[model samples]
Target: MPAATSTAEAAGPTAERAPHTGPIRWIVVGSLLTGLLLAAVLSLVVFAGAPEHVITGSALLGFAAGWALLAVLSAWMTSQPQRWAWVPTAGLAATGLGLLVVAPGDGGLTAAGWVWPPALLTMAVWIGVRIRRALAAGSGRWLLYPVVVVIAASAVGGAVETVGLASDDPGRAMPGEVYDVGSYRLHLNCTGSGGPTVVLFNGLGLTSANWARVVPGVARSARVCAYDRAGQGWSEDAPQPRDGNQAAADLHALLQRAGEEGPYVLVGHSIGGDHAMIYAARYPEQVAGMVLLDATDPYRVGGGPPSAMAVLPSLARLGVGRLPPTSYWSTLPEPAAGQVRMFNANPRGWRNVRDEIATLPALLTQARDLTTLGDMPLVVLTAAGAEDDPARLAGQERMAALSTNSSHRPADAGHGALLDEERGAASSVQAVQDVVQAVRAGTPLL
Candidate 1:
């Protein structure tokens, strides 16, 4: 009895410390979760109401389900905030699947045009509740005022950015014809009487149709043209592998079929930028100058769906690649309905991402074997991205390095600056004008 009593006395403090530790643990977990949830909610505010084509009832339903799941997860856990954070993120994934499977480009909500206000409001509400509980705990008491300011500022900034994304003017694509290049075809839209043709190569998941937002400015003086690359939009797919050389060869055939003149000004975005570099190197006489818009160097990075497909191998095997997209109101099944929502939510944008994914293998090779434009005048537009995103930030950095190495403009703009809401397209217009002036004057556009 004496020995037992002694042991009990020794264990008493440790046992007492354990229960007191509970609130501390909960506070730490809750704090981390609060920050993460706030970030996600902010991102969603910018993402949910984008200028997307898909706006289906099913997609909305899926988003609601995801939101509900996330909220439940948040409320269910009595202590750990991490549980709540994962709820929306996971649900968003499921909803994205549903969006990917839907057809008719039905994907995300575009009823309004900005990402911050509603997001800030939601975050503020969540934070207010969390803060109340957190303040009672001594650890986060000092952070109360700063947190309030952040919530209010986020709402204001988001509203401003949304206003910036929308425009009173409705842009339109110029008229043109289809140019058949051996195995595939390209839809060409050109303007101007006769000058060095400014060729626009659409990026992955893009087509000639997207240029309507920016083509008008350059059309006055230069023979500017925008075309849907083979296997995209109205263009047909090629049996030949998509490589730099093959792309150049196909382009030669396209030019011949379309009766387009030589010494064209080539402007490309993302993967198309790789193709432009190749085309200029392979056929210098046919090319005059080049413009790269937040271009992706396939040599440095992987092609197609870097996420879901190339990055996540386990999910890739499960056929995220094969899954039909979930756009707005899509007619998709179980898992697939969840994918399209995400694909549609992207800001750089994609109208037909799934079809583009199918051709990624060929473009992978095309992305390679592209370098050394030599004397070709090149202007590169670098994209500004968040610091947290290494992939995006690194890709833009590399593109800037390439442009600098090639003796071109390596300035930063929004990722989709060419289709930018305000001053975004201005950079492109200036680049084109410089190229046109150089070409017309018979001077080096380096």
Candidate 2:
């Protein structure tokens, strides 16, 4: 009796661990239905005022069929590691044909938006499931890393493609400017005022156009210019780097090239915040003050040694641009579509942005340690409603104190909050104004 009881106990754990059943199947099916419904609704909004004859029920049916075909193909091909290469190669070919043959017509199929969405979704979910299965089967550690690499590359390429298309499109530009500053074009938009210059830097995967909402208000009091960095928006590619020191040099050159006056104040967002740090460190004489908006910490963030995939961005090219299943990892609730699409065929400009940003981890860490701009005043703004991670805020405070001539503290603002809510935006703008005032008054603002 005792032996039988022991045997039953030994087998209990195995019995409890069962394979996924009907509920899991239902969940996947439901998600598919949800995606289909969402796609149909979005199509309706896009084709709303078009001739009823044009956006007929049959059009929706065609779209559904197209999505189904894409999903099936993506699921099958993404399983093979080597097939990942074809995704980007195909994307580039499609993009080339798009740029040469098809332009973005009023409502016609353009290269930028033509081949994404379905491709991205089909790819991401498929890759994710692959990863999950590998983990379940306790796959070899070596094989898992390579799989991750392919996914990240696809993500970055997809982002770059998305941003490229948006920036190149003629209708998308501001009335006064045609260039996005991320590339080397030096498309600086300076305020009319002759006061000290306030030069702003954008974060990863973003163009200078991101500062549009803040520029108008800041320009009212002083000269504020925002331009995209190289390989971002409409800016030219980088000869050096989009890192801190390089970014600072770019800003200085732009001031000289554009014939804008300076003794500039630097304002940066996310990775741009790190760039600001480097600029101050390298050229303290040029910077009047700095405001870091949720900058990445070189020491703790990717500045340190990254995974094998992060090191070889090309490896990422091979992954089916799938993202983490939830928003736990990234700020975006929805993963950018370009990541999953075949890189060459994706018309979205986002892939380029992702690719450029991923390679900057080591450079960003180097940027953070630069402290020559210490004489300048500093204000670090962190997001309030962000994940309650003390390490993040503490790191900012530590960096700020180290960089400052005097005190260290937090500015009362949230990450990207300035653009969203009334109070948040007001606070962000006010913080900039305060720095300007301090600089103008010749006071120690840090």
Query: Each model's number of backbone clashes?
Result: 36, 47
Question: What would the per-residue lDDT of candidate 1 be over residues 346-372, giving only the tens digit for each residue?
Answer: 332242354355455566556555555
Task: Please report, in order, the local distance difference test score of every candidate based on alpha carbons.
Answer: 0.54, 0.53
Evaluated with TM-score, which candidate comes out highest? 2
- In order of appearance, the predictions have TM-scores of 0.48, 0.53
List where candidate 1 sits over 4 angstroms from the true fold. Answer: 1-174, 239-244, 304-352, 358-365, 386-412, 444-446
Off by over 4 Å in 2: 1-168, 175-184, 239-241, 303-348, 385-387, 403-413
